[model samples]
Target: MTFEQHISGNIEYLERPGSIGGPVLVMLHGIGSNAASFTPLLDHLPRDWRVIAWNAPGYGGSIPLDAEWPLALDYAAALKDFLDRLELKRVLLAGHSLGCLIGAAYAAAHRERVVRLLLSSPALGHGVPCGGALSAAAQARIDDLQTLGPDGFAALRAPRLVFEPESNPEIVRYVRDGMARVSLPGYPKAARMLASGRLIDDAERLQVPTDVIVGAHDVVTPPDSARRAHAALRHPWRGAFTLVPGAGHALYQQAPVAFAAALAALAETVG
Candidate 1:
């Protein structure tokens, strides 16, 4: 429940020591999500592994970022600076959704410092299907940001991402609150990054082992995109990709036990 949080380049983070040493797991949250959202997975993690979760600029407790900063380049730089500030030379970076985009870019840009990578419910922007509702929905989100600002954008999108229509009201509430807390400027710029981002290409040449976990019922990023990512990795450095059962896009919330099992197993493979 208690841990020392770090600050760098307008981002705030909390680090939890795990049962194993050597490779640390740096977890990143999705757009409109924050460090606190990973609490459930944290419980199921090993104490020996160094676990770090950060609030992306404008989400959680992190300060809002510049509206002009939409490129992954800036985010990748900030992440590098953050790690440098914390004195972590190498880490096992993991992320979900928008966080996955950042994690992939960070790993690719600083291949020397990252030992491995794990992505959950990833939305590989360039790889997202150009046709169908996924494409249409993505466009709609961008349009909404221009029209409704961040609050309205957050209100409209969080539910579709968090749960299915069949989910319980309590679960929906938890997801909604997290999305709602995100500031307007942060959300819009972050969304713009997502709309323009292309992390799968960045992950292609990565030399470290990488794992991708997807929820079978995820409508937001979907399982197909995960499969495409798994295919994109270097042959020898390829990692496992799994689609968890009975979960929507927010697998960490809808089925945290399974998500943790996958995450803990990732820890085991750190060597």
Candidate 2:
């Protein structure tokens, strides 16, 4: 099934409508990615379910937040606005990488609105306080973007996001292309959010069923980090942590079938 891209209010999203009154799945991408990052995973998803992936604030045609360094809650507020604009009361929220931080904040703040939560290759932010000095890792990302530009930065970093670029050239190229499209304001803002975010704090407050998935070979956010995030979950889904072997940070793209299976498993549990 093909996804139709559209702008709802200030948010741009890709949607594939399924059966009327069918289950809804909403996806949030990582800092370097936009909604298109979820396209591959969406194709493998159930045809009877509705899926929507949003370009977080500052990406695509979505408006940037007013704050120079927006917090996870700020992004959560933007997410709330996007969902409200779509008239969606409840949804199964799936977040990847940096998106996990935002999703955790949203789910914790509005637990009633999220039916289930799935976090992939979760990035546990550096926990730097707002207005404080950024971590060396976070500063390096910002420095790379500024020094290398989008294309150069993407070329240099995208390869590391996947486990084996030689084996998954197409997926690597896809990820590289997505990263290359990340522009200013949004990219920098997301970096700052990462510097300040501590996903575990929000994860600990979550009352909804949650699951964590990570690439065993992921270098960006390794399985150990994913396990830590899973351990912090207040209500872990089936008390499980999924490890996608031979995949990396971009697990959804590198292993879409496994990612889809995870979503299918979540649906089964809820139904």
Candidate 3:
């Protein structure tokens, strides 16, 4: 289900080979997370698709990014290099949270190399600058990032992001423990980028067929923002938005079956 191989860059990944042999699906996790973050999604996956979850530099088992890792473009470049090394010229890109932002940027910049893009908890743009409120929120995240490192962050985040644990405490705990193990420095920078990063103006020109998956209870990136993003795309069909009821931002973990069902439905459009 997982393995380590040296591509141009050292990448830790989870690979679920599909029998159909199309472009390998490239899955990128949100910031402060790793390739293994999508275990739930993998579990629901079928053999017709080769699913690979990539650990962005400094997260999970991937090598650490340079201290001065390129902000947005640098990250995109890494993805480009990564795909090229794997000999996958074009790929189906699925990303969550900050990873969504990264995937969108890549697709927008290299339209020729992307077949489809699926975004979950996407970071379309910075939350409306709510004066001090936004700053306060960001600072709190920064503080937490510093305090929790990987494990603590996971512990704190799982309960909030995943569906109620009384519903399935052990399941939630399993995810939290993995999240908490994420790379330290990678977590804060990811948070910083999402807080101030702007992609709305750029995504206005994205060309690939794209879908935004939103969880109804997602406080991280609300549905209203998703609707705004949906309206902004030049190709509206290329950027559809779907909501997951009774789930939060990490629904792929909280409710993998539903998430896979949605993704499978989207696959039909791609075909």
- lDDT for 263 (candidate 3): 67
Ranking by lDDT: 2, 1, 3
For each candidate in turn, give its C-alpha RMSD to the true structure in angstroms. Answer: 3.8, 1.2, 3.3
Predicted candidate 2 versus true structure: per-residue lDDT over 1-271, tens digit per residue: 6689999988889999989978899999999999988888767888999999999999999999989989999999999998999999989999999999999999999988998889889999999999999999989999999999999999999999999898889989999999999998889999999999999888888888889999999999989999989998763442468999989999999999999988876675463
Q: Of models 1 and 3, which has the larger lDDT?
A: 1
What are the models' TM-scores?
A: 0.86, 0.97, 0.87
Each model's lDDT? 0.75, 0.90, 0.70
Off by over 4 Å in 1: 2-6, 18-23, 65-69, 126-139, 142-155
Off by over 4 Å in 2: 235-238
Candidate 3 per-residue C-alpha lDDT over 84-137 given as tens digits, one digit per residue, 9 for 90 to 100: 777887777887878877887888899888777887777664643423234455
In candidate 3, what residue range of length 10 has the lowest lDDT sum?
Answer: 127-136
- Per residue, candidate 1 scores C-alpha lDDT tens digits across 49-119 of 78888888766667665655466666777788778887889887888988888888888878888777888
lDDT of 1: 0.75
